[model samples]
Target: MDESANKMNKFDVLGSMNLRTKTLLAIGLSAFILIVVVLVSFFIDPTSITTDWSIMNQPPSLEHLFGTDWMGRDMFTRTIKGLGLSVQIGFFASILSSIIAVALAFLSSFNKYLDSFVSWLIDVFLSIPHILLIILISIALGGGAFGVLVGVAFTHWTSLARVLRAEIKRIKTSEFVTISERLGKSKFWIARKQILPLVISQVIVGTILIFPHAIMHEASVTFLGFGLSPHEPAIGIILSESMKYLATGNWWLALFPGLALLILVLLFDIAGENIKKMLDPASAND
Candidate 1:
C-alpha cells in the first residue's frame, strides 16, 4: 500500500507537468512585455504639452522622448498610446477571428456542401491582398479604429479557418472519435469528450500565430490613413502623420513607433514559436 501510494504521487506530478510548460513560458514573456508597456503608457501625458512655437517637428530631448509632432503634441506619449491601441486591436481581433474560424471549421463537420463553400471562401480571401482589403474595409467602415477592427477581423480569419478545418477533419477520424460514433454518442458528446480535448491545443497554437499577422496588417492600414484616426494616437496614424515632418530632421516620430511595432510583432512571433513547440508532442515530451 505504501509503495502504491508513492507510485501514484509520482505519476500525479508528472501528469501535471506533462503539458504546456513551453507555452506558459512564451505567454509569460509576452504578458510581461504587454504589462510593462501598459503601465508605462499610463504615466505619459495624454494631451498636448508643447506650445505653438514648439510645433511641427521638434527633435528628441529631455522632455520630449520621441520628439514633438507637427501639431506640437508630445510624440512620445502619442506613440505609447498608439501602441496600447494596437495591442488592444490585435488581442480582440485575434480572439474574434479564432472563434469564427473554429466555428466555421466545426460547422463543416456537418455538411459537405458547407465545407466546400467555406474552403472556397477561404481561398478567395487568401488570393486577395490583405492590405488592400483592409483599406477598402476601413473606408467602408467610416475609418479609424472601428475600421481597423472591421478590416482586421474581416481579413484575419481565412487562414485560421483553413487551419481549423484541417484540425477538425483530422480529429474526426481519430480512434476515439470513431469509437464514440459506434457507441451512438451524440455529436456534441463526441466533440466535447474527444474532439475538443485533442484539437484544442492546435487551435491555441494557431491563435498565437495569428496575432502577429493581425497587428502587422492593422499597422499597415492605419499608416495608409484608413485605420485609427490621426489624433487618436495609434502607431500607424503616428507614422502616417510623421511624413509631413520627415524633412525637419526629427526622425524619432516615425522611427520610435515603427520600432515599437517591430518589437510587438517580434514578441508575438516568439510567443507563437514557443507555442508550436509545446503543442508538438514530440517536442513537448522532451
Candidate 2:
C-alpha cells in the first residue's frame, strides 16, 4: 500500500510539472510568433514595397514568397509592414483603453453620483453599433492611424470598465476595506494599496482581451476607407485592393495577407486565454 502511494505521488508530481510546462509553452509560442511578426514589420524597408512594374501581378513562386501585386510590389513585404503597423496601433490602443477602463472603474466606486454617470455613459457607448461608432470617431478625428487609435481606445473600454467597477464595488465591501476606512486611510491610499493590487489581474486580462479586437477594428475601418489613407499599405488597403483582382484568378493577393492577419489574431487570442488561465489559480492546473 505504501509503495503504491509513493508511486502515485511521483506520478502526480510529474503530471503537474507537465501541465505547467505545457501552459508556459503555449503562452511562449504565441508571444514569440507575435514578437517576430512585429519585429519583421519594424525592420523591413519601406522602399521594398514600392512598385516594380517588371514583376507585377506574378503568382507565388520561388522568387516571391507571397507573389507580386498589381503594382509589382512584393506582397510578403507589404503584408508584414501592414501587420506591423496594425500591431503598433493595436498595442497602443489596447493600452489606452485599459487605462481608461481602470481609471473609470476606480472612479465609479468613489461616489454614487460618479458611479451613476459612468454607468450611464458606458450604456450610451455600448448601445451604438460598434463599427458605426468607430467610423464616426475615425472620420471626426481626420481618418488616419490616430483616428483609429482614438476610436478603438474610447470604444473598447466599456466592458472592461464595467467589470472593474463591479470588482471595485465588491472590494469596497470587504472587511479590510472597512478597516482601512476606520483606520483613517485616505481614498487614494486605499485605492493605491488595496483595490489596485486586487484588481490588477483583471486589468491585465482585460487589456490582453482588447488587443485582437483593436487590430481587427483598425483593419476594418481602414478597409472601409474611413481609417488609413490609400497610400498606406495597411492590411485593410491590401485586402481592399485585392478585391479588384480576385475575379482575374489572382487569389494570392488577398489570401496571404488575410491568412497572416487571421493567424496573428489567433495567436493573440491564444496568448490572452493562456495568460488568463495562468493568472487564475483555480484554473491554473487546467
Candidate 3:
C-alpha cells in the first residue's frame, strides 16, 4: 500500500510539470534514443547482418525479431544500422546547413544592396523543387554519401537563412544594436556579438527541424538510385532492395525498415517541435 502511494505521488508530480518542462523532457528522450541507436549500430557485429542462404526469407520470430531478407540478412540488424547511418547523415547535414544559413544571414545584414541580392537568392532557391535540386547537385558531385550530404546541406539552408535574415533585420533596429553601431563597432563585430546570440535559439530549432527532411531526402535519393551506394547498409538501399522481393509476399523486407524509418523521422520532428515550443516566448507560460 505504501509503495503504491509513492508511485502515485511520482505520477502526480510528472502530471504537474508545465508544458515547457515536458517539452525539455521530450527533447532529452528523443536525443537519448537517437544516441542509443547510433551507438548500437556502431557496436553491432557485422556477421549478425551478413547474408546466410539457409536462413533467407525467414519471418519474424524469437531468433530473428524483424525477420530475414531475401538474402538472409537480418532485417532487424540492417534496419538498426540503416537508421544509425541515416541519423549520422542527417545530423551532419543539418549542422552544415545551419552554418550556411548563419553565414548568409549575416552577409545579408551588411547593406541594402547585399540584403536585396541575398533575399533574391533565397527566393530563387526556394522557387526550385528541393528534390529536383538535390538530385541535380548530387549527380553533379558524383553521387555518393558526400554528394548526398552536399546536396542536402546546400538545399536545406534557404528557409533557415530567410528566418535568420528576418531576425537579424529586427535585431539591427533594436536599441542595443543601434547603440553598438554608433559606438564605432564594426558590422562583423556587431553581428557576431549582438545579433548572433539573439538568433541562436532559432538556429538550433531550425537545425533540429531540418534533420527529418535531411533523412527523408537522403533515403528518397538513395531509393531512386542517386544517393548512397547500393553496397551501403543505408535505409534507402535496404528499402530499394526490398522492393524486388516485396511482390513475392516478403512483406517484412520493406515493412519493418520503412516503419522504423518513419518512427525515427517522427521522433526528430517531435523533438524539433517541442524544442521550438520551449524556446518560443509566446508559448512560455503555456
Candidate 4:
C-alpha cells in the first residue's frame, strides 16, 4: 500500500508539470536514445557480422536476437550499423540544408527582387517530388553515399529556407534593426548582430525535423539501388535483399530492420516537435 501510494504521488507530480518541462524531458530522452544507438554502432566490428553458412536462415531466438539472414549475418548488427550510417548522413545533410537555408534567407533580406526570387525558387523546388529529385541527383552523382548526401541536402532546404526568409523579413522591420541601419551598421553586421540570434532556434528545430526525411529518403533510394552500394551494410540493402527470401518464410529479414528504421525516424521526429514547442514563445509557457 505504501509503494502504491508513492507511485501514485509520483504520477501526480509528473502530471502537474507544465508543458515546457515535459517537452524538455521528451527531447532529452530522445536525444539520449539516439546517441546510445550511434555509440553502440561504433563499437561493433564489421567482421563479426560476416556471413556464416552454418547458421543461415535461422529464426529469432536468444542465440540470434533478430535472427540470421540467408547470408547467416546477424540482422541486429546490420541494422545497428545501417542506422548509424543513416544517422551520420542525416546529420550532415540536415546541417548543409540549414546552411543553405540561412544563406538564401539572408540574401532575401537584401532587397525585394531577391526576396521574390528566393520565394520563387522555394516554390519551384517544393513542386517537384522529393524522392524523384533525390533519385535523379543520386544517379547523376555516381550513385553512392556522397551522391545520396548531396541529393538529400539540396532537396530538403526549400521548406527551411522559406521559413527563415519570412522570419528575417519580419525581423528587418523591428525597431532595433531600423536603429542599427540608421547608425550606419552594414547589412552583414545587422544580420549577424540582430537577426541570427533570433532565428537560430527555428533553424535548430528545422534541422532536427529534416533528419527523419533525410534518413527515409536515403534508405528509399538505396533500397531502389540508386543510393548506397550493395556491399554496404545499409538498412536499405538489408531490406532489398530480404524481399527475395520472404517468400521462403524468412520473415525476420525485413521485419526487424524496418522496425529499427521506423523507430529511429520517430525518435528524431519526437525530439524535433518537442524542441520546437520548448523554444516557441507562444507555447513555451504552456
Report the C-alpha lDDT of model 4 over 72-167, residue by residue, as the tens digit. Answer: 888889999999999999999999999999999999999889989999999999999999999999989998899999999999999999989989
- Between prediction 1 and prediction 3, the one with superior lDDT is 3
In TM-score terms, candidate 4 sits at: 0.97
Best prediction by lDDT: 4
Residue 285 miss distance in model 4 (angstroms): 3.1
Candidate 2 TM-score to native: 0.93
Cα lDDT tens digits, model 3, 1-286, are 9999999999999999999889889999998998899999988765666779999999999999999988888889989999999998999999999999999999999999999998999999999988899999999999999999999999999999999999899989999988988899999899888888899999999999999999999999999999998888999999999899988999988999999999999999999999899889999788
**What tens digits encode model 2's per-residue C-alpha lDDT throughout 16-74?**
77545777888999999999989988999787668889999999998899999998999
Query: TM-score, each model?
Result: 0.85, 0.93, 0.94, 0.97
lDDT of 3: 0.93
- Compute the lDDT for candidate 1: 0.80
Angstrom error at residue 208, model 1: 1.9
Rank order (by TM-score, best first): 4, 3, 2, 1
Global Cα RMSD, each model: 8.2, 4.9, 2.0, 1.2
The candidate, 1 or 2, that scores higher on lDDT is 2
Q: Which stretches in model 1 have alpha-carbon errors above 4 Å?
A: 1-27, 42-45, 48-52
Model 3, TM vs. native = 0.94
Number of the candidate with higher TM-score, 2 or 3:
3
